[model samples]
Target: MSTTEDLTKDLSRIMQLAASDPHDIGPLLNYGLDWMLRLAPFDLVAVFLLESDHLVVKAARGPLADARVLRHAISLDNFTSIREALATCGPRLFYEEDHAHGEGDPFDGVLDFPHGHACMVIPLCFGGNAQGIITFDRERCGTYDSQTIQLVEIYAQVLAMAIHQAAQSQLLHQLMRESNERERILREEHQAGDLLSPLQSKNPAVRELGERARQVAPTPTPVLIHGETGTGKEGIAAFIHQWSERRRQPMVKLNCAAIPESLLESELFGVVKGAFTGAVKDRPGRFRMANGGTLFLDEIGELPLPLQAKLLRVIQEGTFEPVGSDRTIKVDVRILAATNVNLQEAIGERRFREDLYYRLNVFPVQLPPLRQRLEDLGPLCDSLLGRLGRRLGKPPLLLSENTLARLRQYSWPGNIRELGNLLERAAILARGSVLTPNLFDLSHSSDVKAGVGESPTPSADASAEAPMISLDEAQKRHIRMVLNRVNGKVYGPGGAAEILGLKPSTLQSRMKKLGLERKVHFEA
Candidate 1:
């Protein structure tokens, strides 16, 4: 047994170690155990910290020091000695020899302790509150004396102060980390809001489109957005996803036309390990990643017929098998599909599935071409310049009156995308801040030639004048003239669609019926 002088020296050493490094609880517990063994050798020593109503073993010595044993928790209701010590804010002792075996014993032969042993549980109290419990166990009976118990009670008080300070510091650090994460999320949301602000246009067609988007955003119904290429169909899909209830979750996107047909199936549905050549590991597909969220499939018309049927299954049943596995995985993904091709015409040609079209066309949102919404041109130009100027680290470029007039007269076939590209190019060429009409390189553009609404000047000879033609002949002549001016480019910017004010699909159908071959090569 340790004398009073020896116990006093040990307590001083423990306090010194704790004062030097208060954050490290391991060293303090180690020194306390050393002193405890000198007073009365124990089979096990466990220090359990009080976390709410449960005791979590923070440190342990001897046979019970294993990770699994240390992690085990003890409820206050399960142990009378631990509960008594916490209630009295002092120490309590329990001996197996003093209790009956079957019905009256507090341990009841079920507790994980040494058989036929004595235990001393001292509650570590500081500031009139119990912080933790330090338990000591010995194989022999009557191991704890009154003097040893009194010394340990003093040691428990010092340890409690150190533990309470450390816990408060850890909690503060956790709060700071969470605060930083919230700030980062807020900043990203602000930037995304600025990017979508320009979509709110004053044009009647665009306002109607916004209204339609808001109407369908809160539901699970699939939406199909139709427009010409570069008409912001994908942007509308993004707006719907952001406004939906699933906005907090991720929105996965896949461009059906950008990926190859052979790889499209595996990309949409996940693949297991050894399913195919070079597929060494299991990979999750976009559907699984976007579970409980939204999935935007762009250029959905480009999906092959075989995959289209499989896609319809996912839409109808919310379940699909991987490319090579027979296991069917279930997901709850809301789909939003976009396409520039005319599905009705494709259905007539027997190229697109009618049932699949009906399934995807739950709510159709059509975006008008830039030419049809010419009133928004000036605002769109200003919005684009402001955004692009920030990205380029330069001031926003101003458009002269002549340059703005020319832009308004020329038909925009590529819609907002073409206008944004033109502004970006002009901004780069602009000296200081002003942009002139001469900076625009539209000399070879067919839209520029047609916008003037006049043909090349004829020679000053009266004999060169031709007679007036029939309306049917005149329409044919005009179609052939624009097609020739653009060198047969009919679909994209500067194509016949821009000059004729028609969709690409409509123009292709008209040309085919008019017996006009589309093999004429044009400069892109």
Candidate 2:
């Protein structure tokens, strides 16, 4: 028989072990129950809980019950005293004299089993909710003393708290797992949607060019863009600026050809107040305004040779004196120059400075004309038409197969800018939802409609068959057809460039080259 001293010492040892590792709750619970049973001399202890539809064995000692215990009804009749004790908020004790088994005791004839026994049922409560019941039985012991029953009740309270904490932890883990999975799915969908956007380039050449531009955008190199006019040169320059280290700063643009040679110097290097007849207040030049940013000079080839020297000095040394001012201003700027004219040819003719050309040509990117990449027309047209429809506040429009086919065959000399303008005009003028062929007119056509027979044979029939229209007359008729198709709105929407498959800039240049301006007058 264990004395009280031994029980106290054993309890102290178990408490020390439990305190050593609070993290290992499973082992701590089982070890605690085992130590308590050895010291307190209990025959069996059963820990069961009604969870969902099954009665689960949570913790146990001795041959009390198997882990796969079946679920049982919990009515007042089956466990009268147990239910009564739960309502009374105390443990229930059945004395050996009062105990009775109603025809269901499997171990009745076993060595340590007895039909009549003493047992106590303690209700497990956590946060005011009844979780389960704990039972301790003794075959020979008459009944548990009050002190022993009180100790058993204290153990049940601690065990219930641990079980409740474990359940909450499991729920939190499940919620975190589900949240992580949802975030991963959202990221995947976002990436897939990005891949389907119109700006996602599939053309190898364009893709490579875009990648290269991105790589160079962070640098402060002087980028020289070579492409025909109306190819969105300024847009590319703006993109480079936006992606560069100086994105937060301003990007100043100067049209080298638009400002006259006499005023170009003052325009670039600002004049002091009252220095010139039109000068009212002191103003900053392009270079000064673009300090710590970018300066995009379009039509760089048109800069006069005299002003080129001053521009070159500023670009090379970052020091320039404003016109009519002796004070020199130093600026940190990224120079991006664009031109449609051949600079090398201009330099050979002494029209452009060779040294300045080399300075600006440090990083050159040649944009391919739209005619070279005809495959991108479909997506480009779709995007342009969608934007145009939105801007015009009209129903969505679709280009007919014949119209698209004709567009693909036409040489788009003006590139994307021309295409956008064409769509805008077509959206406004289109009578129905479809852009038909009659809304578009092709320029630079060969004489396919003219009869290709040999010279007329001498006869009345031959004279009647001979065409009276001369080549010049045919050329005038073609020009009129092109103009009529564009609705006479030149330079922007519904322009000659849309009909001629040329950029507006390109059309203007071609009109100059072909002397079309002499025959056709442009209304302001």
Candidate 3:
């Protein structure tokens, strides 16, 4: 048994907890039950809150139950004593002798234990309102002294106040979040369009690009389309094939960067049944599938040096021998390659072969980024919004004039793909027919300079505007800076890999691609 001083300390601790202004109601229920059980000799104690119309067990403790015993619940209709406690806003004591078959036992049909011989349900009340009942049960059929009951009632009052305050705070936070999101939606606007079909824009640059593709479609000369990521290089390749003589034949597509180096050769050329382990069946690679048609190889710059020589051989002689086979298969396939990588820089780094570059770059087509082609924004939005709205079950989505102006001022790092995705998201969030987006909704914020690739800002030393550095150059600087900070440690805690959030193997691969060998950069 605890002394009078101990009980007084517990009451004060609960009172202080109620005054602390908590955001969650769970802690109050748990802490209150811990103290309530100590006031009397109790084998079981559980707190239940009236949520909607059901009395749900929120927190509990006993030899038969753990602190997280919230899986039990009962409706007020099935709980006569609990309903009486909530209705009178007072505590009611009961015994097994008074109710036959434990008809109104709070834990009846809820827990797989006896109702015990004696139990009581106390209404959790504050400000003349009640939300739930707290249950106390004991093994022996007996009475709780008036002093103990009085002490428990006082604790209940403090607990009820604490739960009320925390619930109000929780409700307030939810409302504030909803209110903030609504306010943000009202302040910005955008419209979207789909690019599943070919782009026929009013812009002369876009028109000329389409005409150029049509002109080259008739020739056997290989073409390479190059641009920043998300500028739609794949679309250009498809457009050329659509107008080509081999349009009826299959135009097989492969992304050279997506596959591992060890298996890349097998993917490009056919593989025999016993080429390598797990090669149980012979497979005709992408080249054989696209025979008599066109083969579009995206991210061609990522092709390994050894594979590059083989790719060149296929282009020159139109012949390739499958792995682990002596027979040579001939295919008259026209290759169309695409790359975001600056291959000139890749060749200088020796990551890309110089001979292979000339073979693929027979004719090059550079697609202008979305930021440079603002003339197409209005039409693009109108076209994409209708498709997006219909797809999302919100038809005919529209954009404001102010949104178009805002779009022009911002630099689009992801280009047209980013633009389409942004619009689709806005349509999903839009309350009505009009869609609005927050000004800084883009992945790259406003600080990213506008027309980044179109024209570079002037250098401090030079009188003329300096060209923007290539993406590879930027990555090299960032990686080297981290390496220097870690004293050139490539693995382990506080090393370059940890700082960069990259696996050591992945870091090694990137370093190799950028020609950043350990001996060359770290030691030389």
Candidate 4:
């Protein structure tokens, strides 16, 4: 094909590709680089896209550089030819090695082509401003003729539009992420207020726990929030972060158990670009995101032993290297860890590092389970209802006297979360404003009154000598009663295991040891 025909054909395909997938131009750029090599006299061609004030090799053809070398970010301010070309670019940076016309060009000392006899530069423009540069270099001692230069310049224009399309897509996605992040922050701040409401109540223990949280909030000490699952551990963690000096910054969180063991380290620290197959871009992990704020690691006892050592180092030194990158990054993140599992038990099993446990336990705070502090139930229900009402667009939410009394009767194995979920359900179900006890299904709740799961004590004279059940019998009867209450369901939501605050697997294991089953309630 003629040179003009070739340029027309290549430019047509490039425009079609740009219009089709503007978000990613990798395939288009790579294919275009091949076409450029075919069209130009140069043996080498490279496309340097501007990113954060540096020109990075976006694509290349021939013996220009290796894959790693292609990513090298040469500063635009430092490269004279690139700077001048980009600034006055409808006029190209015409470099002839024999004459030194464009001296100290082509990334100067940084990225010089080994066989460069002469080179031509084309500044890429989008919206009247230069966004990148295209360099064509040849081994033979000869300058580009006018016709070849003009054809190549046409190709450069086509390439520039593709680069701009990719950049715009990236910018649009980034703006959307930022907008969603703002909305999430606002939602959290409101939830934090609700979480703090129980701490402000007349209950002495709840008030004291809040006071301890307030005392520790100002310090940079690492806080360990010890509590059962659904006991508002996350809420207390958020409360501490909100009352701290770094409240204005982000409070990023991660649940250790929720992520797989292999991927947890990268999530906590970070991953460098090309670190693994999927790691195409650098991810600044929770530690970096929570810099100058707090990183709350929920279910912390599930953290594996190997990562614990690295975590200990970060806690002590405030520095960690991202996965696959040797460079150390430092951050001033306040660490807050929560766990339903006993770390001491984990330490005894040799599953957790001893040193990491001590480092994270500097300011330990325990959240009392809801059943233990029944006095706060009224206040908790009120706060949850008001929030749920506004969120669900309901008229109003009210807990009937009978419902509150029944709430106090049940042993809330699920704690505050269960209460909130229960209230939300009630509000959804109710035709009127009043939420009755029937909204809390009998199968999901227990008959254990007063304190949760505590057996009633007999007066000294009445039952001192009465025949007492054996410990095994007592356990068997209790398990049977809970199982019967839930109608033998063990694993799904509203199961007996959940009401008993035990993992279904663990519950099954215990049943095997005690020789119990779904239907059998052992007794005479």
Candidate 5:
């Protein structure tokens, strides 16, 4: 085709493509470059944009220089000609090659393009602001025709419009993505935020544990969660998935011990239609359902020995066969296994596979019991109280000083989960705003009440009753009292940190400063 016809055809196509898929700039720029080469006598085309800290290669079509790596950034203050060109043209075309020694020019001393024989520069503009530049270079000598130059300028204007619209679309897309991410995070926080606090503990070990949990949330590494039964292992697993790359995907859960041994395989790996007498239809397994997401195997230690081998095979190969089916289906999933039972012991007993243990234990996060974080008790109470109060729709409840003091003296056999349950119950029963000593359920705090009743005795109670107690003695006594109430539990919902109205992390820090034991407990 002739130059005019070719330019006409290319420009038409660029406009069509931009109108059809206005969100994409790649297609529009590529079309422009193809025609700009054919209509003109240029062998190379490059597009560049000055980003915040560096220059970016927007588009390039040639075999000359390493244009990808030739992302040269010039300071706006230092390179005045380039800056002026941007300020003036902003999407205009320039044919100047040796602009360094030009009269009345801002660039007094600069290197001209010696290797680059001749150049045609086009500024990319949007909304009166210069966005970038598109340059076409030729190796041999030739002056562009007036008609050809006019045509190129017209095409450049169209190209600039396409670039601007594409950029606006991309900016909108990015804003939407960020907004979705923020909303998702806020929802997850609303769902799980009431369960833990950062200021509830001052112990280093507890703080370290919380930090580990936070750090592991964004990773796909298989997490092995270890803790007592009421320690909120499932909560940790959910936290990890909520903050991970696979947050949008499903979080499948199965209690290994809850399902019967005979049905466990079908439950985990799914079953084909008519596989067994009760099999009704082709079914997707938990692993398949949790594809591109997380699968939480609660009480992993209870998985039958025979099923353990199958589980191991699936974990290793990402493929599993349905019950009575030979065909293996593949899936992508992150495993999060929680067990109150000691996995090492289970492995020693030949109940759990060693290979599976290692696979799930890629990142092990152990939850501390409630008694360990006395400082967290207070905040945990506030959180739980708020939730329960909202659920019950009553006046805001307050945990009385005496009630909290009494709570600090008991050993919580059930960890954070237990504490949440206990507080929820207490909050419901509390007639007034205060959670008094009558609401306490544990047996360990009997002595705290007993000691409170006796008027005068020559025991620790006598010394504690004195009004002129030293600050050192008072702090130590206070610490001892809170520890006694919680029975030394720390690092979870409703632990000592919750009762104490502090973050488990903050309490942990204070404990380190005080040189407290790793296992902090309350003793009346």
Candidate 6:
């Protein structure tokens, strides 16, 4: 066949494959790269697919085809030619000699291509928007003529269309899967008719909270969950999302405290290319991602004051611009925010915006501390044990009656999370199906409560003959027991301070006030 006929046939074949199965972009890309190699002599070919803010190598041909590095992502800022091509939605060419002025080759450490060559980078543009990049590298310099570049651009356009079609198909499939999963969950919920089963609390405070959640779940009102750390705030947020009318849509979560302030804005509101040093492409923020769904912001108090104003605008107007773009994008997102800190106190300190707090606190739900709801301890233990048992491949560890009484005597300052940690440790130490108080590290149970200026009460079944000591003497004895258990180690994990749930400094201060020393002798 003539060259023109071959080129025409190749383009026809590409269209046929793309139209045959829009869900399979892998075969299309692989076949296109092979055909391109046959049409033009090239030492290497690589295809990078745009994902969020980075280009990921989706397919590669030539010597390094099987290299594990192909799976890694390449930031747009790392390559000048690719960035330029993406910015202009066009092709870029780089020659080895162009970097003779001591500027190192861009692909020197990136790819193991043969030295002293030329590379052609074609931005995959569809509908005047760049989706990704396809690069061709030749061992010989200046191998791509004007006609060849034009042909490459045309091929890129075809590939871009196929990729975009496949992406849309994948998204459709994802939506279907989410719908199915949501249906399954709704079916189970309907069958049980209990949305608060996950909370597993019989305590009146928890029951009231669950009832409040049920009442607010059907509304589009913003919910602000307030509690101390480890008080199951996120769990409450998840419960709210599952019970809400928008349960079919995903609930995207972000921890304001986990992300650094410098990057938190872009993470929440997203950014366009050149928005910052590493932003290589336009990306959607959590608000856009959570459109028609719920956005659960954990540790909402930790959100910086500057972003607080932007977040308030989104709540009020349902519109905001990306980090670098002035175009205001509107989204319908249900806000569900949680905070362990007191936002009112933060407002008083001038650290948090008072307006934002009011916006989020439209339907406030405050969770009770574990100590206040001691009646739920037994059920919580059973639930946690069942979960941990299955995860650890062990039978459920049963807590003895005496152990329950012992647990109820001490106040849990860390709440449910601390109880879980302590239970996990005891479960690991337990040799039989039954767990005893000996398996736990509650030696400082009285001391920890005392350190916080709380009095520890004895179990209900304590013998009548037992001597009653002053609170200070009881605290001293408890602290002494914890120190003895760890062999005088005061700091670090598994030490007296950690096991007692007291800060090292606080533990030391209590020890000094009680006239206790590191070398103090104890009864074995």
Q: Candidate 6's C-alpha lDDT?
A: 0.75
Q: In terms of TM-score, how similar is model 2 to the real structure? A: 0.46
Model 4 regions lying over 4 Å from their true place: 1-40, 44-58, 62-179, 196-198, 270-274, 277-283, 323-328, 443-447, 450-524
Q: Write candidate 3's Cα lDDT for 1-524 as tens digits.
A: 45567657766776566556444455667788888666877778888887667888888877756633668888887767668779888888876554565455766655444443667778899898897888887777676777888888877777887777766765565456435533442232112113533348766777888888888987878999998888888777876876789875656778998999888888889676657997865666778767787888999999999989989999999999877666788998989999998999999999999988998898899887775466677787887777777668886888755455445544566787788888887777666776543422543463233433322332222223224455455456556666766777889999978765568998889888998876655521
> What are the lDDT figures for the candidates, one per model?
0.72, 0.65, 0.72, 0.74, 0.67, 0.75
Which one is best on lDDT?
6
Give per-residue CA lDDT, model 5, range 1-524, as digits (tens): 67668667766777677766544466777777666764566656666666642335556676553533244444556545566667787322333444333322121222234432555666666566777777666655444566766766667777877777666665565456445644554465465656654324465666787678778877767899998887778877876777688877767788988988888999889876668998865556677667778889999998888888888887788888889777778988888999998888888888788988998898898877766666666777787788778778878888866556556554566767777887888877777877765665554433233333323221222233323323333345555566666777667775767765458887777667666765644356
Per-residue error (Å), model 3, residue 231: 1.0
* Local accuracy of candidate 6 as per-residue lDDT tens digits, 1-524: 87678767877777777766655567788877876775556767888877666888778887656676466577766666677779899887776565453333434566665545777778998887788888777666665788888877777787788777766765566456546644654554343232235346777768878889988998889999988788888777777878888877767778999998999998888887668898865567677667888888999999999999999999999999889876788999999999888888999999999999988999999887775566777887887787778667898679977677556655687888899899899888888788776666666654242332222433333242133344456557667767877899999989988776567998898899999988778654
> TM-scores of the models, in the given order?
0.51, 0.46, 0.46, 0.61, 0.50, 0.55
lDDT of 3: 0.72
- RMSD in angstroms between candidate 4 and the native structure over all alpha carbons: 11.6
Which candidate model has the greater TM-score, 2 or 4?
4
Per-residue C-alpha lDDT of model 2 across residues 225-274, encoded as one tens digit per residue: 88877765776677677668987666777899999888888878877655
Return the top candidate by TM-score: 4
Superposition TM-score, candidate 6 onto the true structure: 0.55
Worst 10 residues of 6 by lDDT: 457-466
Error of 3 at 352 (Å): 2.0
How does model 1 fare in lDDT? 0.72
Displacement of residue 389 (Cα, Å) in model 6 is 1.4
lDDT preference between candidates 4 and 5, better one: 4
Structure candidate 2, residue pairs in collision: 414-503
Question: What would the per-residue lDDT of candidate 1 be over residues 227-311, giving only the tens digit for each residue?
Answer: 8998878778778888899887667788999998888988899776558897764567778767788888999998999999999
- Candidate 3 positional error at 496, Å: 32
